[model samples]
Target: MTVRPAWLLPKGQTREDTRLAPVGTWAPDGEIRTRDGVVPGGQPFAATGVAAMQLQIGVGRAAVQGTTAQGAYPIAVDAPETLNFTDGNAQFARIDSVILRVYDGLFDESEQPLARVEIVEGEATATPTAPTLPPCSLRLWDVTVPAGASAGVGGIDWGSALADRRRYTTAVGGIIPTGWGLSFAGAYDGQYRDADGVLERWNATDATWETYRAPEPPVETITGGLSVASGWSLSSFDARRRAGVVQFLGMFARTGATLPANPNIGDTLVATLPAGWRPIVLLEALCSNGYGFGAAAVGGDGKITIRSWAGGNNVSGIEKDTNVRISAAFVQ
Candidate 1:
């Protein structure tokens, strides 16, 4: 299929394309699939105002240089059942109306497109499978196993190619891309390998193997302007703002407001500019205890600017604006 590198929606809002479509907005016809009987009596799904969920790729961030480590992500929001009800007094919890907001990005080595997504469902694990994969990226039945039959959760082996880990022992509720909140990335895992990979959750005795597939996107070829097509490569970033973990994927072009202080000696560019495309919530993430850090923003248009603090402290010590040529799509 023809995959492009762009988010359908702006930050803090649902993508226009998803305004009246399924939560998995990027999924065309089929991209991934979930195991039958996996969700049990799949109660029809739907969504309306999804504006408070989180998104994240499920791959290890740790990797060698030259490529991103393999990872996984959910194109849907899997959550627990609410307003509980059932068939004829048999009140088994049921969940419905899970929505996911997705953003598209560059392709990886396997020609797979990276998708940043969010789910607002209660609780579910997003393996690299579908009812989630975009239409052009799936052929699910080709690897189907028996329904209701426990694979790794009970007794399934995912071969020896993947690292053996613990798996889940139950068929918990699954979500299909519901929610629109803060998220870390697109695609499932960061690693878009060119071959089969595996994921396992602790299942008491041993790690249960998950049934999934992968469509690795090619992350080669560094660019000049660092657009989505060029891959926004920032100069330096603040890991202090990192919520949990911090890893530098790539350097970015400088796009900050000129400062008045003399940063000639040792002024490392901490945060990155929205120069490539546009930044929604760009902030300097530090490696500290997630506190004592600072943040500021240029408008979505990115015309507003701020100079770095002399000592990297955003306190009310002293700040100065710059007289320089800046570019932004939106005005401050």
Candidate 2:
């Protein structure tokens, strides 16, 4: 039964047969499951305060991967598992870890695929540090035992003494838990993950994770301050801005009781383009005076001035009754 199927167990199959591959299939291998950690969801292996020096771990499931020879092992805690810590060192504090461990007889000379929850006591020193996890084990929590602490006399404070070491994994392509990215390298470019509350994508070239932001609309319409110069009134006009470019389309007609026989080449048409709508350098556009062609210039000061006018017969001035049409675009 070296190459056994993971599912559809036959009637005569033994316990060892299930451990061969059924458990691994139930929890597939991938970036998420192949890593040693709790199978996230529903308070898996939650540790709670119990009597002094005692902690109770709620039922949970986890995956543990050992050497290639030992392969992977899955653990399930159907009932609560209570762990008792050794009496605190009389002179200094110590850190102890609750771990889910797999012991394979083929590799450990013990029961084949034996899984259990156990405590690995830490060394007591002036600055106590947690014990190192052995191979084929997943740490669930770290408990700090202060000096002189005992079950009944000066018991441990569950809140301050317990440090959660549980990490989580999900099905492939699923949103992994926060902090997962900090420990594992991204699988590919454009790989996405939830970083705390923000969505981020991996950048393979830069070897970094960048925040994802939605694209914004590019063009905006200019709504106000398109006033015409004295003796001129707007007929139809539109002004829009995109990036650093500003565009305009409009018709201006002469007004007032007295009108010049012809508009001067230096006469102003638009008084100002308003702040932020001005150009960095002077820009010119060819215009029409209904009867002849001319040119207009927009200065950095926001004024639009008539630069030239080829009135009928190649004249330099525009007829007073002729309407002016200006269509232009410039970059600020």
For each candidate in turn, the TM-score is 0.19, 0.58
Runs of candidate 1 with Cα error greater than 4 angstroms are 1-210, 220-222, 226-276, 285-299, 302-304, 311-332
Candidate 1 lDDT trough over 10 residues, lowest sum: 59-68
lDDT of 1 by residue, 1-332 (tens): 11111233234334432332222222111134221111112322221111111111221111011112212122222332122111111222111122212233432433433432222222122232223433212111111121222322332121311121111111222222222221212223221111123332223233222334445443322222322212112343221112222222232332443323443212333333345333454433222212112222343342223333333344221222211122222211
How many residue pairs collide in each prediction?
71, 0
Give one digit per residue, the lDDT tens place, for model 2 in 97-159: 998887766677664545778999999889999999887888889899999899869678898
Most TM-score-accurate candidate: 2
Best by lDDT: 2
The Cα error of candidate 1 at residue 247, in Å, is 9.0
CA lDDT, candidate 2, residue 122: 97
Q: What lDDT would candidate 1 get against the real structure?
A: 0.24
